[model samples]
Target: MADGLARVREQIAAASARVGRTPEDVRLIAACKTFDADTVREAIGCEQMVFGENYVQEAKVKWPDLKDEYPHTELHLIGPLQTNKAREAVALFDAIHSLDRHSLAKALSRQCENQERHPVMFVQVNTGEERQKSGVLPGEADDFIAACRNLYGLNVAGLMCIPPAGQPPEQHFDLLAKIAARNGLSELSMGMSSDYATAVAYGATNVRVGSAIFGNRFYPPAGQ
Candidate 1:
């Protein structure tokens, strides 16, 4: 685990240096989805404090005790979020990377009011316009971001994106960075384990990496 982290950090530094940016310019989000609590503890032991999870329920099960033990660790939701889970999500995640719709924005807004806990939000843009993805289409991002702020009062801190699979990711990363720049957002979360180096070149403020640090994920046998 330590070796994996070291290699990823080295890649980050090399990429950042290529563009005259320091590694500190980018935040590494260790994607911990599908991994158990014990495995996550090993990551914490390696001083990898920031993490990202996909589901609210899974995080609810594993993170409470972990967070209590490692109070400095930050957790983020980096996958599709259901409106029904808004309350628990607002409470559990330190940040959310999937604020992609007005309905979800409204739900999260209400949950924030109810819980008095406002998690940092990133508007996910479907740069590739894929039909099966969760992000707002790229063209609608401006209005959606405005609505999230003006209508719902959610602090729109940044933007997130997942480039279409098998496409040149840099183009999508460029699009995300441009939208963020025009919107006065400085944080861009648009990288993953596979292409984080290229993402850094295009000014990604945060990168979500999992397999690179932890190796391939092992899913339970169906119906276990």
Candidate 2:
């Protein structure tokens, strides 16, 4: 884990230098989906403080104890979030990277009010316009972002996106950066293990890297 993370940090520094940005300008979110506490702890021992998890239930299982042990670490929800689980998500996540719809916004707004644990929110934009993806379509992003801030009162701090597979991601990254620029948002949570360097060139403030840092993941049986 130490060697892998060190390699990724080196890449991040190189990428940032190419664009005249320092390594401190980009935050690395160690995507820790499917990895267990031991693997994640190995990362923490390497001083990797920020992490991203996909499932709320899975995070619930792993993070509470981990957070107890390392109170300074921050956790982010980087996958689609269910409205029914908004309360728990608000309490557990330090940031949420999947605020795409109005109903989910309403649920999160209420939870933030009830719990007073307002997590930093990121509006996911479907830059590739993929039907199966869970993001606000690019055309509707401006209005949606406005409503999240004005109507729902959520702290919409940044934007996130996942370009369509097998396509050039630079255009999508550029689009996300433009949207963020016009909206006055500074954070852009795009890129992954594959294209983080390119994303840094496009002004990504955060990159979610998993496989490149943690290596290939092993999942349990389909129906455990």
Per-candidate Cα RMSD to the true structure, in Å, reads 0.7, 0.7
Residue pairs that clash (backbone atoms under 3 angstroms), model 2: none
Q: Give the TM-score of candidate 2.
A: 0.99
What is the Å distance of residue 13 in model 1 from its true position?
A: 0.5
Model 2: residues with Cα > 4 Å off, grouped in runs: none
Candidate 2 residue 210 Cα shift, in angstroms, is 0.5
lDDT against true structure, model 2: 0.96
lDDT of 1 by residue, 1-224 (tens): 89999999999999999999999999999998999999999999998999999999999999999999999999999999999998899999999999998889999999999888889999999999999999999899999999999999997899999999999899999999999999999999989999999999999999999999999999989998
lDDT tens digits, residue span 1-224, model 2: 88989999999999999889999999999999999999999999999999999999999999999999999999999999999999999999999999999999999999999998899999999999999999999999999999999999999999999999999899999999999999999999999999999999999999999999999999879998
Q: How many times do residue backbones clash in model 1?
A: 0
Model 2 Cα shift for residue 123 (angstroms)? 0.1
In order, the Cα lDDT scores of the candidates are: 0.95, 0.96
Candidate 1: the clashing residue pairs are: none
